[model samples]
Each structure stands twice: as structure tokens, then as C-alpha cells.
Target: MKSYEEINEKIRAGRAVVVTAEEVIAIAKDIGVKEAARKIDVVTTGTFGIMCSSGAFLNFWHTKPKMKMQRVWLDDVPAYGGIAAVDCYLGATELPSYDPCNSHYPGSFRHGGGHVIEDLIAGKEIKLRAEAYGTDCYPLRSYEQNITLKDVREAFIFSPRNCYQNYNVATNCGAETVYTYMGVLKPHMGNIHYSSAGQLSPLLNDPYYRSIGIGTHIFLGGGEGFVAWPGTQHAPFDPRNERGIPLGGAGTLAVIGDMKQMDARFIRGVSLTGYGVSLMVGIGIPIPILDEDMLYYTTVEDADIQAPLCDYGKEGYPTGEPCVIGSLNYAELKSGEVDFQGKKIRTAPLSSYTKAVEIAETLKQWIVSGRFQLGQPSQLLPGGGSPDRKED
Candidate 1:
């Protein structure tokens, strides 16, 4: 078995054999896992989709008169200022106080926290407003100014939850169309929307979390980042098929990166037609070929990964009950249409597979050019048992 040190040495010498998860499928098919593991040094995987459990932290220099800011807003969207005097965390889903959220059905929440983040990264000037109760040492009560990413003393993206290993395919079964975070679901099983890169997804390639964990270096929104911790609601013990791939949403990741270094293309503001706003994050992770099993896992194809089907309509989803009706493989979901209950239904993906491939290629280039190296995870994700492969 190869170690991380060996992989880095190869990368540094510009002699490493790196391939995207998609490319590895063919390599393994031709040479078999044993030979593929000996020849391949790393496998790159990527995903680009809406990650609502994401935000940024900004540390600003104290304003004149040293006011302890109590309330904060960036471009009319509210931010959490319960921490330090000049620090605020902007959540992706936080909307403006003025937004008439669904009070008028299908509210047009044009701008929110996610847009503010993208504008900041794009070097656009942001209008900042704050209010504070006058303090003994700080006399200023109100403050207003325009700022950009460069103006902040420190800024970073720290997401509580970023990449999900798998997720549910959403549809509507009720008579009325339902507007949810998965997007608008038409009534009576009218349409289906699934959001995962399938075989190219980082977690799917390393299904057991063997190569991805806390302290693992990653590409986040076109910038370098690291896995921070097990994400919120991380449940690695979910039911799985014989290949050890989870059948539903299972493991997740918490990641952090410098916001100033992020690119606008990979970090975007997404406004769901009726579900407010969220950040579209592009993330990539490189999995080291530790053994034949690890290389074998990376060979998984879209046909082998399955997503649970859930109803998001008023009857099943709105009632908050567990509503998984069935399951569908990614190959079927990506085929432009799927056969659900013997009725042909149209299918669409919320996640961008093309962008995912681009991210994977970008990462491979980084490794080939000796610009990036593999990092050994300090701690593996909890609840990951032995991966079951075809040979096993």
C-alpha cells in the first residue's frame, strides 16, 4: 500500500499519475483495480451545487468612536452580529428584513446574503449599515459605509455543511405545485429534480471517507480550503448497497477557505424561483490511491449510485413526515427522463455535471503541474466502516 508521503513526492517531482473520477472508470475497466492502483497516484472528484448551510465571516476594523455594533446589514440583507463588536457572519439563506416571504406566494427574493457574498468576491462595493446602543467606552450609535472584500481586516468562508454524500430526488404528488428548496415541484408527479454529480462527486468516489476527512486539503470555490469537521447532521451509517455507496443522504463536510481568493464563477449567488437564496459552491477533493480498494471505489459509475425519491408537496413534505417514496439510479436521472411508477417523467439536475468535470480537470492540472500535493487527514470521519467492493 502507498502512503501520502509517496504520493506527495510524485506530485512534487511532476511524475504523479492523476486522473478524474470519470477517467478512472475506463482505466480500471481496462487494467483492473490492482494494476490501476499501482499506476494511478490520485483520483480527483468534484461537485457544484447549492449549499444553503454556508456563509462567510468578516472581521472589520473598528469604526471611528469605537461603536459596539449590535445590528448589521450588508446590501439590505441581515447578518448575525452576536459575536465581536466588528465581526459578523452572513448566512447564505438569510433574507432581507423587508422580504415579504411567501406572504405573497412565490415571493421574488431578488437579493439576499448569497448575492452579497458573490458581489463581495466580484470586487463590487457593498453598502454596510449598523446600529448600536451607546456604550461607555464607545460613543458611536449608528454607522454606515461602503466596503468590499479588500476593506475587511479578515474574511473567510466557513460552511457548517458543504458537500453531501448523497441526496433525495424531489417530486410533487399533491394537486398543487410546491415551491421548496429543491425547486418548484409540479403537481401529480409532474417533474423530478436531483442534485448530485453522481460518479464524479468527491464523497461518492471515496464512499467510506477513507481519503477525505478533517484536515484534508480541498478546492473550494476556486480557492484552497480544508475539511474542518463532520458537518451538521452527518450520518455516515445510512443504508447502503453492496458497493458501500449510501442509498440516501449520508455523510457531509464542513469546510473553510479564504474568501478573498475565491473566484466568482465557482462561487455564485443562486436564487431559487420561490425558495429564497443560497450559495452555489464548487468543491473538489483529491483522493490518494492508498490501495487497490481505494482505486476500485473511484471506478464507480453513475449507474451504481442511487438517490432516494421524496415528495415535497403539501401532503407528504409540508407535513414534515418521512416521505421517501422510492429510489432511482443516477444514470436514469441523467438520461433526461426517468420511468417512475410506469409513467415516463422528465428529469433535471440542480447540480452542474459539466462544472463538476471542469473542477476535476482543474484539480488534476494543479497536481500535474506540482502546484498542489496530497494532505493526510488528521482524523477520519466517524462511522465509516470497511468499504465493500465487488471482490469482497
Candidate 2:
């Protein structure tokens, strides 16, 4: 069995032939799978989309009286304070202020933890406040200060769930418009919005988790990180096609890495009109050409991928088994139109395709330059045991 260590040595010595997922698709078709897989050493996969489950953990230094923070706020956005002294989890969608929750204020709340996270990553000053009852050994009761990502000893995004395998295309067939986390759906089936980079998504590329096991080294938040666990809501048992690819959402990833090491270009805080705030996260994973089966899967294309067109405007919608309007290939979806209700419905992609390609190219350069060396996962994910932690 060829190991990741061997591949890293090859990459370091400039003997590895790396290609982006899109490029490999054409190469595989032209040269045939056996020859293309024989020549290609690594295939880079990428995705750039809104991940609301994202959040960051900030570990602060001990205060003057050595206070253990019981209440915490960063840039006016509340973070979970019960974890431990000076440690908190700032969720991406958590609003800076509570929603007014009145008829006039419906769905207007915006600024939240995601913005603060982006600012900190940008190396800008951020306000922090915490309150704690005085203790005998750790006496300080409360604290207020302005800090930056540089000021902290530890700062990393510990996203519990990200990079879904596939997603539905949203449409509105009702008389009025509807707002959803999937993006706004215009009334009368006016527009269709979908995400996931079709063949470029990591999980989608290795649909059965054949090569994307827990310890796989990946491009994360603009820096190198590993898949920590099977992300929450993971349904590995979901039905799959003959090729083992799930027709819709399947595997997810729990990833963690230094926020300070990430690039702002691939990390942005976004406000999704009626959907509140979220992080536009960029991620890339390189699938090693371990075998012919892996190679064949990586060659999958947008035309081969499929997702259901679920009506977001319908009342049963999300919770119930959505009445799939229809299934369509990403190539059809990306053509900027979908056939629906006897009319052509325009389409839009919520995920940024340009950034997704940039991530893949960046990872490719790292390998070609011998700068991004791959690591053997200490163990496999979730069941593989916890990963080793280190400070950047």
C-alpha cells in the first residue's frame, strides 16, 4: 500500500504530478482512466460556500486576579462561556444583539459572531467583555478589553459541521416569496438557487469515504488542517447510487485549524438578507491517487452529479420529506436555467465558483512547490480517536 508519507516525499522532491479536479476530468476522458490515474499523483478538490455551523474558539490569558470568566462577549456578540475559564465558542450565526422579535423587525437582525471572526482574522482590534463572580483563589470579577487575533495565544475555527456532500436547488412555487437558509426563493418559481461545486467538492469526489478518512490532510480556512471527525448530521448509511455517490446531502466534516494562519481572501463574514449572518468558508482537499477506483470517482463531472429541486415556499418544506420538484444535473443547473412548471426558471449559485477554483489552485501550488506537505492522520476520524493539538 502506498502511504501518504511516500506521496509527501514525492511532492517534496517535485516528482508529483498534481492537477485540479476540473482539469483531471478532461485529462481522464482524453487519456483514459488507467493512463491518467497512472500519471496523476494528486487530484485537488475544493468548495467555497456558506457554512453556518462554523465557529471559533478563543483562549485568553489569565487576568490580574486570575478570574474564570462566566459570561463572555466578543465585539458585542455573545459566546459560550461555560466551557472553561477564558475559553469560549463564538458561533457564526449568533447575532450580536438579540432579534427584536416584533412584527416590524421581522428577520432584520444581521451582525454577529461571524463578523467578529472575520475582523479578528483581518488583524483588527475587537472589543471583549466578560463577567465572573470573584473567587478566593481567582478573585477578579469582571473584565473589559480590546484585543485582536494576534493578542490571543490560541485562536482557531472548530467547525462542528461543514462541507456537505450535496444540496437541494431551492424554488418558490407559491404566490409569495420565501426566505430560507438555502437563499431567497422568488415567487412563482422565478429563480432556482443551488450550492456545492458539483465534482469539485471533496466529500462528493470521494463519496463512499474511501480516501477521505479522518486523518486526511486538507486545505482548511486557507491553511493546512485535517478532518477532525465525521461532521454532525452525517448520514453515511444514506442511500447511494451504483457508484456509491449519494444523490443528495450525505457525509460532512468536523474540521479545526488556526484562524490566524488563514487568508482573508478565503474567509469572509456575510449577511444573507433574511437568513441572518454566516461565514463564507473556503476549503480544499487533495485526493491521493491510491487506486483505480479512487481515480474513477475523481473523474466524475458536473453533468454526472444530481440534486433535487425542492420547493422552499411550500409549507411542508424542510422538515417533511420535501416533494422533490425534480432532479437535475449541475451542468443543467449551472447553465443559468432549469425547466420547471412548464417554464424556464433562472438559476443562481450561492457558492462562489471562482473562490472554489482559487482554493484548488492554491493547494496545487503548495504541493508543486514542496511547501504543502501532507500528513498521516494520527488516527482515522471520530472512531479514530481525538487528534493531536498544537499551537501555531
Candidate 3:
């Protein structure tokens, strides 16, 4: 018997390449019952529809010079305890016609059935006997009738039903392929939702449904919901709406909510990228935007105005004696007071509650000076803040 490392080395070195089920069983037989069962973790089949082909083949290359072997695993044989008996078909025709927009109702219904089965296997509550149909139904009049809708439907019902009882059966069967229909269907029954009419309908609007879809397709577990946000295009609620004030304007204030509610775990004063902000934004949940001071306007500083004059000739200025004047002189000339504008333009202390206000004023100045340009918001000001608060 080969050791685990020896088998793994064979696999890695390309000496033992089990690309097909036949190869897998062959290796299993060669390695003996105990060793074969231990070494071979999982054997899966995938099916694809061919447009102009009659036979499909699996191919791979072993780059390792020391190992060169190819193996195939076919389900057509019965000696393998008919393990391939679980294979089912999946096609559009096999599934009931439901509006894709409202398809969630049916999808959820089917998924809920699968979920129940999972819960039972996990020793949870035994809710109900729910199952999903897995039969590949193609367009009836399409060129390929060899794998007809009827064939898929019969394959799903009889094949899976024969292998296991109480499990949902798929009515859409295709060729044995990776991730068999039964393998995919079992987990989904728990997710299906039953309607008042006793018909299966998916829980369409549930955020969990979207999360599951995203999690499955992208292989992102619960925490990976961040990537789902960009795909869903869900935008965070604007605090300005709730406060009845525009951001960067007078009377605007920041709103701070419990960061914990946002699922933001604090780590050494640095919020991890995927935790708090991602969760809040991904699910379209409203979060507190520090709105204590979001907007303010202030007189342009002498440093700001003079800095530009030094870079560009004062040709546009109306006969200015000196465009690039010092701060003290500019303040005195503009305000007729020594410390009026100059003192007001200085950066405020960090302890000040008006930091947001101060920043808004600076941002405005920057925009006016053409030093920066702002991108368009995902949504506009009218939809900017929460609408619960009355306009001030």
C-alpha cells in the first residue's frame, strides 16, 4: 500500500492523474480498499451540452517529468455499487416557468426545502419534507433531442429517487458531470419557500437570499459580503436625509451611530476593511455619518489666493498692484482690520467640533480654485439624507 505522502506525491508529480471517474476507481482498486478509500477524498462528475459533438472527453497534462499517467472514471458501469445512480439532469424545461424578476419566490421555496434536509442532517429541527427538481430542460424544438426534456425529467426523478428516499428529486438530467444535480439540489431544499397556494415560491426579497447567491457564486462566506455590495449596487443611506440638511452646507450636522451595530469590530483603533464598513454598505444598512459639522463657508485665505498668483501671472486681475500679497497685508487691505481674515483662516484645533465644517469650506475653495474636481455621487442631494427628519 502506498503511503499518503506517496499517493500525494504521485498526484503532485503527475504520475497519478485521475481526471475521470474510471481512473479514480482504477486507482482505488490498485491502491487496495482501505488505502483507496483513505486517499481518494471525493469523486465528482460534471456535464456540459455539446452543440455539434457526439462524445465528450476529459483531458489534462502532467508537467512532472517523473510521472506520466492518465485515468478515466465512467459512470456507465454498474459494478461500482451504482454510485453514479445519483446523477440527475438539470435544464430550464425541467423547472417550472416562473418570472425571473419574481423568481426568488420559487427559488427560495426550492432552497428552503434543501435547507430543511441540511438542518435534519445537522441534527436540527425537522421542519418538512421539501425537495427541488433537478432536470435539464432545453428548448423543446432545439436541434438536440437526444437529451430531450423527457429524458432529463425521467433521469432526474428515477435516478435520484432510486438512490435515496425522502430526498428531493431533480427532473432535469444531463450527462454525468461535476457537481451532480443531486449534490447541488440537496443543499437547496432548506431554502425553498412554500406559498399560500401550496405552490413553491422563493422568498424573493430576503436579503439573505441575495447574500447566499453572492456567497455561493463568489465563494465568499458570511464575512465576504463586502464584495457583494459592488455587485448589488446597494448604496448606504445618506445621513443628510435623516438630518434634513445638505452635506457641506449650513445647519448640517454629522450623525454617529453605534459602530457595533455596523458589525465593525475595532482593532487597535483601526477598523478592518471587510468588517464594519463593508457589512453596513453591503446590506444597504444605514450607518452614522459623523455629521456634527458637515458644511460651512469661509472667506478665502490670503495664502490660498496668493499661492495661485505666484504660479500664474496676475494678468486676469484688475490692475492689482501686487497679486501675490502677504497674508498680513492682504487681511489688512481686505478687512481694514489687522487680524480679521488672517486669524479666521487658520486651521482649527482637532478638538473643535467644527472639523467637518472647516473641511467643507476648504473643499469649496479647492473646487473654486480648480485645484480639485469632485466625482458625481451615486445618488444626488435630493436623495442624499434620511427623510425621517423634517426640513429645517
Measured by TM-score, the strongest candidate is 1
Worst 10-residue lDDT window for candidate 3 reads 194-203
lDDT of 2 by residue, 1-392 (tens): 35677788899899988999989989998999998878888899999999879999989988887988998999888999899888988999888665552234336555787888888888899998999987797688889999988888898998999999888778877878777777778888889999988889887777767667677788888887878888998766655566666777877889888888988778888877666888988999998887777788899888888888888886637558556878888899889987766799899999988889999999999999998877655554332211121222
Please tell me which model should have the higher lDDT, number 1 or number 2.
Answer: 1
**Candidate 3 segments whose C-alpha is farther than 4 A from its true place:** 1-224, 231-392
Write one digit per residue (lDDT tens) for candidate 1, span 216-324. 9999999899999999989888888989899999999999999998998899998887789999999999999999999999999999999999999888867989999
User: Which of the numbered candidates is closest to the native, going by highest lDDT?
Assistant: 1
TM-scores, each model vs. reference: 0.97, 0.93, 0.14
lDDT of each: 0.92, 0.82, 0.19
How displaced is residue 198 in candidate 2, in Å?
0.9
In angstroms, the error of model 1 at 54 is 0.5
| Model 3 lDDT tens row, 1-392 | 33324433443444432222223335544665455444442221111110010011111121112111111122110111112222322211111223132233212212221222122222333211111222232111111111211122121110110000001112111222212211121121111110010000010011112111211111000111111112211222222222221111111111111111222111011111111100101011101111211100011122211111110121311244433222222222223223322332221110111221222233233323433222212322221233442333
**Which candidate, 1 or 2, has the higher TM-score?**
1
On the 0 to 100 scale, the lDDT of residue 119 in model 3 is 24
- In model 3, what is the error at residue 145, expressed in angstroms? 28
Query: At residue 222, what lDDT does model 2 achieve?
Result: 89
